[model samples]
Every structure is written in C-alpha cells, then in structure tokens.
Target: MKACIYPGSFDPITKGHMDIIGRARNLFPKVFVGVLNNPAKRNLFSVDKRIEMIRRAAAGMDGVEVVAFDGLLVELMKKLDCRIIIRGLRTGTDLELEQQLSVINGKLLPGAETVALLSKPETYFISSSAVRELIEFRADISDYVPKEVADMINGGNAK
Candidate 1:
C-alpha cells in the first residue's frame, strides 16, 4: 500500500494544516499525520493533546490517521514505510526550509520524497504561534483554528 507522512510539531493544529492534510489525503492512498514530539522545543500542548486535537479536526477523514512519534522524522518515516513526506509551504521561508530539509532527508533516506503543498490563500496566513497569540489576547480565533483546538487553547490569558 502506498503511504505518506505529514510531520509537524502541531503544538496545536491550525486551519492551514488541515488544508494541507485534506489535499494530501486526496493524493496519497494512506496519509499519516505525524505529530513530532521534539524535546528541543517547548510545546504549548502535550503530544497527547496535539494528537487529540488533530484527531478531532480530522474526524471522518478516511485513509488519514493522526499519530505521534519521537526521534528523527526520517527514521520514523522509514519504519512507517512512508515514501513521501507532505509539507505545507506558506511563505518563501517555508519553501527554503523545506528544500534544505528535503536535501538532508534525501541524503539520509535516499528515496523519501518531500512534497510541499501551497496553503490555500485564505488559510495561508494562519500559524500555530499566531493562534496562540490570539488566544492570549482573547481575540476571536474561530477562523484560524478548528473549534476543538480553539477550545483547548482558550483557557490561558496574557501575562
């Protein structure tokens, strides 16, 4: 079976992420939305919470599974038998970073493909950090995140 992986910190999944995931689901037979549990970066939500948020956002999405993994993404992709990695490009920086990582991952995995999708214009400006900021200020984030995610992040206030 052809399978692909979309890996991200997903501190809290945003609408932009859901857009890429929906598109990737259309392209790949099986798409695993891998939540990266990177130790180097402090996360707003725990891995379990991120996974739960993704699952809620992706409810009823067939052939798309939400999972969490720690360690090198390349190693996890290899173990998952995923030959493709889906990435969302929202800006020039995103493209640059993704290209660099693709080259590095290529050298490491040889045949793993990194497919970067352009975010839909409407959601392109949304990012998890911005969502967190909006929540901090008590701004309406209904347009930027799914209701489940919005609810999860809305409890905190600005310092």
Candidate 2:
C-alpha cells in the first residue's frame, strides 16, 4: 500500500492542516500525521497533547493515523515504510525551505519523495504559529481552527 508521512509539530491542529490532510488522504493509501517532538522549540502543548489534537481533528478519517517522533523525519519515513512526505506550502519562503529539504531527503533516501500541497486559498494565511499568536492576543480564532479546537482554545482547555 502507498503511504505518506505528514510531519509537523502540530502544537494545535488548524483547519488549514485539516484541509491538507484531507487532500493527502486522496493521494496515498495511508497518511500518517507525524508530530515531531522538537526539544529546541518550547511548545505550548506537550507532545502527547499535540498528538491528541491531531487524532481528534483527524478522527473518523479513513487511512489517517497519528504518531509522535523525535528524530530525523527521513528516518521515520523509512521506519514507517512511507514513500512520500506531505508538506504544506504557504509562501515562497516555505517553498524554498521545503524544496531544499526535499533535495536533502532525496539524497539521504532514494525511495522517499516530498509532495508539496498548497494551502487552500481561504486558509493560505493560517498557521499554528499564527493561531498561537492570535490566541495570545485574545483574538477570536473560531474561523481559523476546528470547532472543537476553537472551543479548546477559547475555553482555555488547550493543552
């Protein structure tokens, strides 16, 4: 079966993310939403919390699963037997970074490929970092995230 790995911190899953996950599901037989536990960046939500959010957001979605990894993403791809890496592109900068990473990953592993999925027009500007900033400023984020996530963020129940 064809498999793809969508790796990110996913501190909080946004609608934009959900959109990409939905799109990726159609292309790959299995889509693994891998949450990276980066020690360098201080996360608002713990690794478990991030995984929980991703799981809830992707619940009932066939062929989609959540996992937490703390090392090289390319390594995880081999471990999971994934042939593709799903990445969301929001801007030219993102494209540059993803392109470079894709080249590096391809060199490191010949079997793996990176697929860049452009964000939906409506959610092109939304991101986990942007959502976190809005939340910190007390801005209403009901439209940027899922209903459950909106409730979690607004209700102060986000982990």
Candidate 3:
C-alpha cells in the first residue's frame, strides 16, 4: 500500500495542518501524521498532549493515524515503510526551507521524496505558532483550531 508521512512538531494542531492532513489522506492510501518530539524546541504542549490533540482532531478520519518520533524524520518515514513526505507550504520562506530539507532528505535516502501542498485558501493564514500566540494572550481561537484542541488549550474539559 502507498503511504505518506506528514511530520511536524504539531505543538498544537492548527486548522491549516488539518487541511493538509485531509488533503494528504485523499492522495496516499495510508497517511501517518508523525509528531516530532524535540526537547530543545519550546513547544507549548507535551508530545503526548500533542498526539492526543491530533488524535482528537482526527477522530473521524480513516487511514490517518498520529505517531510521535524523535531524530531524523526520514528515519521515521522508513520505519513506517513510507517514501513520500507530505509538507504544507503557506509562504515563500516555507518553500525555501522545505526545498532545502527535501534536498537533504533526497541525499540521505535515495527513494525518499517530498511533496509540498499549498494550503487551502481559507487556512492559508493559520499556523500553529500563531494559534499558540493567540492562546498565550487569551484570544478566541475557535476558528483556528478544532473545538477539542481549543478546549485543551484553555485548560478546559476535552474529550
């Protein structure tokens, strides 16, 4: 079966990220949303929390599962027996960074490839960092994230 890996910190899964996940699912038979666990990075939520949030956000989706990993993303892709890496591009800077990473991944692994998908117009302006910032200031984020995620962000009950 063809598989794709969509790896990210996912400090908090934003609506934009969900959009990419939804789109990736339609293309690849199996789409694994790999959440990166990097201690050095100042992530707002724990890896487990991030994974839970993703699971909650992806509750209704089939053939889409969330997993956590550390170290090189290509390694995780290989571990999952996937060759395609899904990335969401929302800006020029993202393109540049993604290009460099794609080149590096290609060199590191012969068969690995990166697929960049432009965000849907509605979610083009949304990002996890932006959502975190909004939450930090106690701004309403109902539209930027899933309701379960929003509740979790506000320290309220979340299923």
Candidate 4:
C-alpha cells in the first residue's frame, strides 16, 4: 500500500493540520502523521499529549496513524518506509521554507517526493504559533482547533 508522511510539531493539531491530513488521506492509502519531538524548542504540550490530541482530532480517519518522531524527517520517512512527504502551505512564505526542505529531503533520500497542499482560504491564516498566542491571552480558539484540542488547551493542560 502506498503511504505518505505528514510531519509537523503539531503542538495542538489545528484544524488546518487536520484538513491537510484529510487531503493527503484522499491521495495515499496510508497517512502517517509524524509528530516531531524537538527538545530544543519549548512546546506548550508534551509529545505524548500532542499525540493524544491528534488521535482524538483524527479519531475516525481511516489509515491515519499518529506517531511521535525525532531527528531528521527523512530518517523518519525511511523508518516508516515511506517516500512521500505531505506538507500544508498557507502562503508564499511557507512555500519558500517548505520548498527548501523538500529539496534537502530529496537530496537526503533519493526518490523522495514532497507534496504541498494549499490550505483552504478560511484556514490559511491559522498557525500553531498564532494559536499559542491566543491561548496565552485566554482568547477563543474553538474555530482554529478541534473541540477536543481546544478543550485540552483551555483546560489548563498546556505547559
């Protein structure tokens, strides 16, 4: 079965992320949502918590598996035996960075292909950082993230 890796920090797994995952699921038989565990960066949610949030957000998504990973994304792809990388693009700035990563990943893993899915206009401006800021201010995030995630964040579960 063909599979693709959709890798991200996914601190809280926003709706935009889910949207991309759904889109990727439509193309690939198996979609592996690789949650990056970057210790260098301080995350609001623990890796395990993030995984749980993703699982709840993607509860009924067939063939969608949430897994925590560290190190290079290509390494995770090799481990998953997947050659395709699924990314969500919201703007030109995101495109520039994602394109660069795609080039580097292609060089690292020969035959690797990165597929960029443009975010829907409604969700184009929603980002993890933005959500974090909203949380800091105790602002509403129901529209940006799934209900489960919003509850987790508002329930004082974040670090």
Candidate 5:
C-alpha cells in the first residue's frame, strides 16, 4: 500500500496540477491530492469547490483521491500514514522554496521524503494565480486550467 501525498492550495485545479497528479499516480499506487484549506488566504473558490473541481478533473485517474485538509502537511501525512510528498517544480524559485519546505518537513517527520517533479513544458507557465487573473479580466483560460475548472470559472461559480 505504497502511497504519497500531493498537497497544495489548488484554488482551482489547473492543467498543471492535473499533469502532476497524473504523473504522481503513475509512480505511487495511491496519490492523495491534499487541498489545503488555509483560512488566511483569500481564495476565489471555496475549499469544497476546489475539491469538487479536482475530483472531476481527476475522475479517471485511479488511486487519486481528493481531500480537504488544514494544519501542517506533515500532520496530514501522519493522518494518512503516507511518507512521500509530491511537489511540482516549474522554476528555480519553486526549487528554492520547495527545498526549504522539504528540509523542514523531513525534520518534522523523520523518514518522510519529498519528491520533486518537473512540470511539462506545456504547463510550465500556467499557475493558479495566473488563471485567477485571467478569470478576473474575463480572458479565455481554457488552456491554463482543466476543462472542469475552466467551466466552473466561466460559469461564474467562483466565490
């Protein structure tokens, strides 16, 4: 029962996110998509909506479970009994930040490891914030996010 956790805000699941989820699923028998419910951050969509969008986007991905969680990611990992954390790296900045988090997470939970996956070139430039900006301007975000997410944004379901 080897499993991994991919934690993120996932304000609205983007194609980049789906790509990482797909790739992670191929490596681990179970990949739990942990959607962080951060009360401090103002999100365009609710955590429940984000989970719903992720579930729809990853519908056919076996072993991929979408869940809402808060507090420390290490805590979530402990709760799920997982030791591997999957993170997507798009740029050097991401590498730096993720590296720091990885070290901290390892210290918090010994034996826990972080796996960094490079984003596909096609989705390297896409981000949840960028997608939100596009949505604010009423721009076409079909290419930036999953169809389910784009549809949700286009349908004005965003909070």
Candidate 6:
C-alpha cells in the first residue's frame, strides 16, 4: 500500500497543518501523522500531549494514525516504510526550507521523496509561532486550531 509520513513538531497542532493533512489523506492510501519532538524548540505542550491532541484531531480518518518519535526523520520514514514525506508550504521561505530538507533527507535515504502542498490561501498566514503569540495575548484560537487545541490554549478542557 502507498504510504506517506507527515512529520512536524506539532507543538499545538494548528488548523493550517490539519488542512494539509486532510488533503494528503485523500492522495495517499495510508498516512501517518508523525509528531516530532524537537529538543531545540520550547513547547507549551509536552510531546505526549501533542501526540494525544493530534490523535484526537485525526480521529475517524480512515488509515490515518498519529504517532511520536525522536531522532532523524529520515530514519522514521524508513522504519515506517513511508516512501513519501508530506510537507506543508506556507510561503517562499517554507518552500526554500523544505527544498533544503528534502535534499538532506534524500541524501540520508535515497529511497525517500518529499511532496509539498501549499497551505490554503486563507490559512496561509497561520503558524505555530503565530498561534503561540495569539495565545499569549488571550486571543481566540478556536479558528486557528482544532477544538481540542483551542480548549487547551483557552484554559478549557483540552485533555
């Protein structure tokens, strides 16, 4: 079966990321949403919490699974037998960075390929950093993130 791995820190799982995942699900037979734990980045939610949030967001999506992992993403792709890596591009910078990452991943795993999807124009401006900024100001995050994430950031029942 054709499978793809979508990897990201997913610190809080934004709506923009979900949009890409929904589209990718339609394209691939099986899609694994891999929550990456980045040591260098400070996250409001722990890795396990992020995984649970993503899992709730992805519930009822057939052939979709939310998982967590550390270390090189290329290795996870190999372990999962994911030939395609799904990446979301929000701007020119995202494209450039994805290109660089794709090249590096390609070198690390010659069998892997990266497929990028541009974020929907309406959600193009949405990002994890932007979400965090909004949260800090107590701005409504319901529209920017899934209900679970919104609840978490808004001091409601998220778990």
Compared with the true structure, what per-residue lDDT tens digits does model 6 show for residues 1-159?
Answer: 999999998878999989988999999989999998888878877888888888878887888888788899988888888879999998899899999999999999997899999888889988888887877787888888998777655665432
lDDT of 1 by residue, 1-159 (tens): 889999999877898999899999999889999999888887877888889889988897899898789987888988888879999999999999999999999999989899989988899999999887776577898898877777666654111
lDDT of 3 by residue, 97-120 (tens): 999999999998789999999988
lDDT of 4 at 103: 93
Per-residue lDDT for 1-108 in model 4, tens only?
Answer: 889999999977899999999999999999999999999999988999999899989998999999899999999888889999999999899899998998999999
Ordered from best to worst lDDT, the candidate numbers read 4, 5, 3, 2, 1, 6
Give model 5's TM-score versus the native structure: 0.97
Q: Which stretches of model 5 miss by more than 4 angstroms?
A: none
Model 5: per-residue Cα lDDT at residue 51: 88
TM-score of candidate 2 against the unseen true structure: 0.95
Candidate models: Cα lDDT each: 0.86, 0.88, 0.90, 0.92, 0.91, 0.86
- Name the regions of candidate 3 deviating beyond 4 angstroms: 157-159
Clashing pairs in 6: none
Candidate number with greatest lDDT: 4
| Model 4 root mean square deviation, Cα atoms | 0.9
TM-score list, all predictions: 0.93, 0.95, 0.95, 0.97, 0.97, 0.93
Better of 2 and 6 by TM-score: 2
Positional deviation of 71 in candidate 5, in angstroms? 0.7
Model 6 weakest lDDT span, ten residues long? 150-159
Q: What is the lDDT of residue 58 in candidate 5?
A: 90
Expressed as tens digits, the lDDT of each residue in 1-159 for candidate 5 is: 989999999977789989999999999999999999999999988998898898888988889998889899999999999999999999999999999999999999999999999999999999999888888899999998988888877887776
Candidate maximizing TM-score: 5
lDDT score of residue 120 within candidate 1: 84
